[model samples]
Target: MTLRRAWVAVAIAAVLAFPWAAGSYVNYVTCLALTYSLVTLSLNWVTGYAGQITLGQGGFFAVGAYLTAAAVVHAGWPLPAAILLSAVATGALGLLLGVPALRLQGHYLALATLFFSLAVPEAIMALPSLTGGANGINVPPSTTFFGLHLSNLRDAYYVLIALVTLVVLVDRTMLRSKLGRAFLAIRDSETAAASVGIPIEVYKVTAFTASGVIAGLAGGLYGSIAGYLNPATFDLWLSIYFFAALIVGGLGNVYGAVIGGILVVALPQLFSQAQNLANILYGAILVVVLLTLPGGVADWPRLSRAVRWLWHPR
Candidate 1:
């Protein structure tokens, strides 16, 4: 078979075998990995591909989670409708927020987005009646589809995997399309891209909207996973973590997004099990990776070629 066909077969087998081979605990980790992967992909569209530096992605994710939880737990909406509505509302807010804020770049943009992210949970804290205030709110039981309920972690795992796969596939396709080229153009030189007739504002706004929509979707799934929502869960620190994950994984590469997602979620859990030692180790590894492998793990192909050349004798 051709390389492409071989890869397709490998992917199919992996998907088919994953759930059955993994135990409940492993499945739970997988669930978190998938959820975060979705968020990373969305963030990548702007941060990695479009060269936008945003730290408020966590705010959008939190909005989606909180909105979904409120709609289902309190307002009694079905999960599907709630998810869609949350995405739309969050996308609208992202567009609204991105418009004025996109005018700033570098430190100014970062600070603005950082402030937005920091404010999100605090705003929830201040709204006791609607958001349950500081103590947070419990998520409702998982949704049912065609008489099958998805309340357990195992079931939620499958849902997340499905969503992550869908989003990744769609994003990979889009990144190879004309719009993706537009995004890169805007990234490299917006002025030159506009000079050649690209719609700079439109692409920038679209990237923000897309990022918000995916973040919201991921947040909705994550709320269900956590089984509760707290103001602290979506704080500015979480945004920092997300950015760190992206940088460590690789920029402008979908595979890097997946690796980064797993590292961000699972590595922390592994650290938690080791008390303070895990943090020291994690920090050490991060420093080493940043210094030695600045291009990220996803750049292994390029690194391999370089190593081969370096060892080759003239």
Candidate 2:
């Protein structure tokens, strides 16, 4: 355990030094990757840990982005307060949706969430006065963080790193608690969990609510980073990409979220020359990963060892 902790510490230190080691462009990209990592981690809580399939994560994400932007742009709220309120609002929305729809299992639940993903952007367009409709809204640069104004990607990277670290710690603590065990129980077998006195309905709703809060937080951070908000930004493809990240990284594994986030953000840039074909390539990669590594890219070490043993017959 000590060795493992040491390795984790080393890895974190490396991540912290990445922006300085790399060029400005790389720093920008890493900032975006870190934001996506937060989103993936949030998705992991509900889909990976609790076995809930939600396609409306984009909607929740947008809720956070737009709410924060509106609060900051119109209401003149401070950045931190806007972000916090956006997360809380999104969590409440998640609870409202989860209470009734979570009872629907399998495809039914997915379809319900899919509709939600479809609805959010339309709702934004319908309310043109606030959301700016198709024209999009411009977010002001965040200034005055505890009396220190941030002015560059490097500063934002530090804030993101701190946020991600807090998320990791909270996530680890939650999964180790009895509440997390109940989530796993519901995921594995809802009926059996209920029979064993696990409040299935309550836990499922709580999981969804928690997931929304995290996604909303990520969205708020993203808006601050991008300094723009649009209905198109949180489309169906975005939700699909989040799901793909979860599968590719390895569901139910924390490390998988990190791996998935880096790939999702980096892959498109790598294929920028063939922008039209990026989605096709992403789909192909996802299929290959699912077929060859059901446990995700996180299982590559074990897979490699097994293959080597097979070949050498040791």
Candidate 3:
């Protein structure tokens, strides 16, 4: 086999065996990272490939979480069923939101999405009966199906691994498809894409819908793993962090989304004991990465080549 394929196989094997040796906390964080990766990847779908800026990811995240939680707690739906329903609902919401987005550009679109982020929490507050308001809502992770219980973090981790693998494949496939070309075209030059008969409006809406569906799925996974939902959890900073992580990990690529998604969550935890030190270190790291790689962590390939060139001088 080729070197790249062999490396990939080894990486997959290591990931599969990770939880076996890792502590509970480590496994839990990895699971959270996987969930956040979904959010970042979905954000990449709309903002990265489609060139549509969004500040409402947290809002859509809340929608997915709440819908899943409500279905499980109020409507007596199974966890899997609730997640499926939530995805569909969020996709519809994306389509509705996209209509207005068709008229917006740059900061105007950003503001509209920002408004959404601001509005979601308040709407939850208004519905204290269902949402539990500030207290949020909880659903124990003791979900059962076919006599098998999924109460362990390891179970969740494995499931996340599977989901991440599937999503990654889908991302790669879509990036090679006509739809992907259309989005990239629109991103580079909308007028040119339109001149070539590409439906800008339809594609824009499709991007939103696809992003929403993926974000909804992420929220569903998060809700299940977290066993709780709070408006405070889906705050404006959460939306902001999606962008931050995307930039840090790299943009317009799936691997970057995963790297950024995982790091954005994992980094704070790694330095949880020292807030000030963590802040300083994070700033330093960001500066170093920006100056050196510029393409974020996923740009290590270029970094490696530069290192090699320095040693060889040929």
Candidate 4:
């Protein structure tokens, strides 16, 4: 295999082996990292791939999580069934929202999604009967997977790994297909893409719907792992965090999503000594990277080339 392919294989192997290689704390952290990576990858479908900037991802995530929790607790549905329903429902809502909202571009669309993100939780809160009000709802015991129950940290880590692997595989496959090409074309130029026989509106809505499904899946998986659901957990800041992860990782690449996702989730834990200091440090790092390396970590090859030229004085 080529160097890139070799690196990809190594990364996958390491991710798969993390539960066995790490302690309880590390395994927990890895699980969180995998979850964030899944969300980031989903965000990339619209933000990175389709060139749509949405600030409502947290809303969709919350919807999925709450739906899963509600279905299991109130409706007495099975875990897998609840999760599937959440994905479908959220994806449908996303398509409905995208159909009308996709007409706008840049900041307008962003503002529209922002409204959705900010309003969703409050709306849930207002409906005391359905959403358990502001107190949030508790998740029930998790279901068994195969023959193993995911109650322990080690078992939970394995479940996250499996889900993340499936998501990443789907992302890779989609990016190599016609739909992926349509996304790229739309991102490049809508007019140009439309002129070439691409159905711009259909594809845009589809991308948003796909992004919703990914977010839903990630959210359901998260709810299962945490065994709890809270409106605050899916607040607007969460969307900002995911967006920051994408910007830091390299928006258009899957590897970048994974790397960025891990860093975004790990940074707060790693620098929890002083909250303000951590934010300052994190913001500084982001600014420095954006100014010096616009393409994020995934563009390391170009960065390396620049370093080599500077050293050689060529």
Candidate 5:
């Protein structure tokens, strides 16, 4: 436990110093990665830990971004307030969706979510006067925190790091509690969990609500950092990417979410000149992981130990 704490401390310190270690563009990318990490973490909770297949994450993400953008641009709300309200609004929506969704399982649930993901952009395009329609909406820069103005990307990076740290801490704490155990039990076997009096439906909905809140928060941060929002940005492909990250990083692992988030954000930049090839490479990597590392990259340490033990049967 002490070693685990020390590793976390080191990771935190590295993140805190990242901007200084890299260029402005890198810092900006890091901020984006952190935002996606939050989204990945949200997905991990609902799909990974709770065994719910939701392809509608992109819908919730779009809702959060648009709501935040509208509130800040039109309602004249502060960024923090806009974010808070967006989270609540999205959480409510998640609960509404979950009530009907929890009845379905496997591919049925996945298709329902896929439809939700597809519907968001259509809804946005239909509501032009409010959502800015197909042209998209512009988000203002994050101006002040507690009356102190943040002037640049570096300042925003610091704020993002702090937010990510807080989120990770909260996630860690929650996963160590009975609630997390319940989520796992439900994921492993709904019948068994219910037989044990785990209140499966209640916990499932709670997981959805929690997932939506985190996704909403991520969307708010993405809007603030990107300073723009359009329907195209949160499309079905984005939802696929979220799931892909979860798979690559290892489902049901918080650290896996972080790794997946970084890869999702960074991979495109690495292959910006060959976008098609990048897509191919991404798909190939997923196939490889699925075939070789069924538990994803997070299980590498265990895999390594097994390999070493086999080679040197001590």
Candidate 6:
């Protein structure tokens, strides 16, 4: 198998082995990495494959998380049911929002999403009864997902891995289908795609909806993982972080999406010393990656060539 195919499996294997090799804290960190990777892959569906930019992913995430938590806590919904329904509902919301915003291309759409990211927090705060205001909802340990109780970190890790695998498979399948082709066509040139009779607006809206589903799934899983839900967690900065993670992982690449997702969670832990320095370091890493490896850390072959060229300059 090609590195492209093997990298994801390798990552999964490494994570699976991590619980045995590392301590509980390390295992927990790995679980967090796997969880965030879903968010990165969700953006991969939007900015990477669909060629549309979104700055409101954090808002979608917030909705999914809160909705999932509320369903379980108040409505007495099962964990899997809550996640699935929240994802579908979020996707519907995405469709509604995308209709008007998709008409505006480039920076305009981005600004619209940015506003969405900012607005969600206030909306959460406004709906005190439903959202728990600033205090947020604490997710009870889910015991109803196919009778598999998530009582320990290991159990959660397994569930998270299953979700990640599902997302990756769906992503890869779509990437190879006609729908994926339409997204690429629209991304490359809207006029060109329209000339071929592709419904640009419909596809764009679908892309946004699909992106929302991914984020919603990730968000629901994240809420369960953290055992908490609050609007503050899904801030504008988190959206920026998601975008940065996508770039660092390599756009239009599934393996890169997972790798980038891992880094977003891992980076903070590595720089846990100063805390403030982590942001600076992340900015520096992003700048360096942008300048040097536009394909991101997962683009190993390109990096190898660069390394060789540097060593054997003509």
lDDT of each: 0.79, 0.82, 0.83, 0.80, 0.84, 0.82
User: Per-residue lDDT for 90-199 in model 6, tens only?
Assistant: 99988998899867878888899899999999999998888899988788875456666554677778888888888888887897899989888988888999999999
lDDT per residue as tens, model 2, 1-314: 56555666777689778878988788878888888888888888888888888888888889998998888898998888888998999999889988987668888888899899999999999988888999999888754344433336787788888887788778777888998788888889988999999988888888889889988988887787787889998888888888899899888767678778778789888887886588888888899999999889877897546434432332
* TM-score of each candidate structure, all chains considered together: 0.89, 0.90, 0.90, 0.88, 0.90, 0.89
Clash count for each candidate, listed in order shown:
0, 0, 0, 0, 0, 0
Worst 10 residues of 3 by lDDT: 305-314
Pairs of colliding residues, candidate 3: none
Tell how far residue 167 is off in model 2, in angstroms: 1.6
The reply for model 6, stretches above 4 Å from the true place, is 1-15, 302-314
Better of 2 and 4 by lDDT: 2
- The sequence of per-residue lDDT tens digits that candidate 4 reaches over residues 54-153 is 8888888888888887887889887778889989988998898889986799999989999989998898788767678788877765565454454466
Cα lDDT tens digits for candidate 3, 140-197: 6776422333347788888878888788789878989999899999999999999999
**Model 6: worst 10 consecutive residues (lDDT sum):** 304-313
Clashing pairs in 2: none
Q: In model 5, what are the clashing residue pairs, if there are any?
A: none
Model 5: lDDT to the true structure: 0.84
Q: How accurate locally is residue 215 in candidate 3, as Cα lDDT from 0 to 100?
A: 89
What's the CA RMSD of model 5 in angstroms? 4.5
Candidate 1: residue 170 lDDT (0-100):
82
Model 2 Cα RMSD, 1 decimal? 4.8
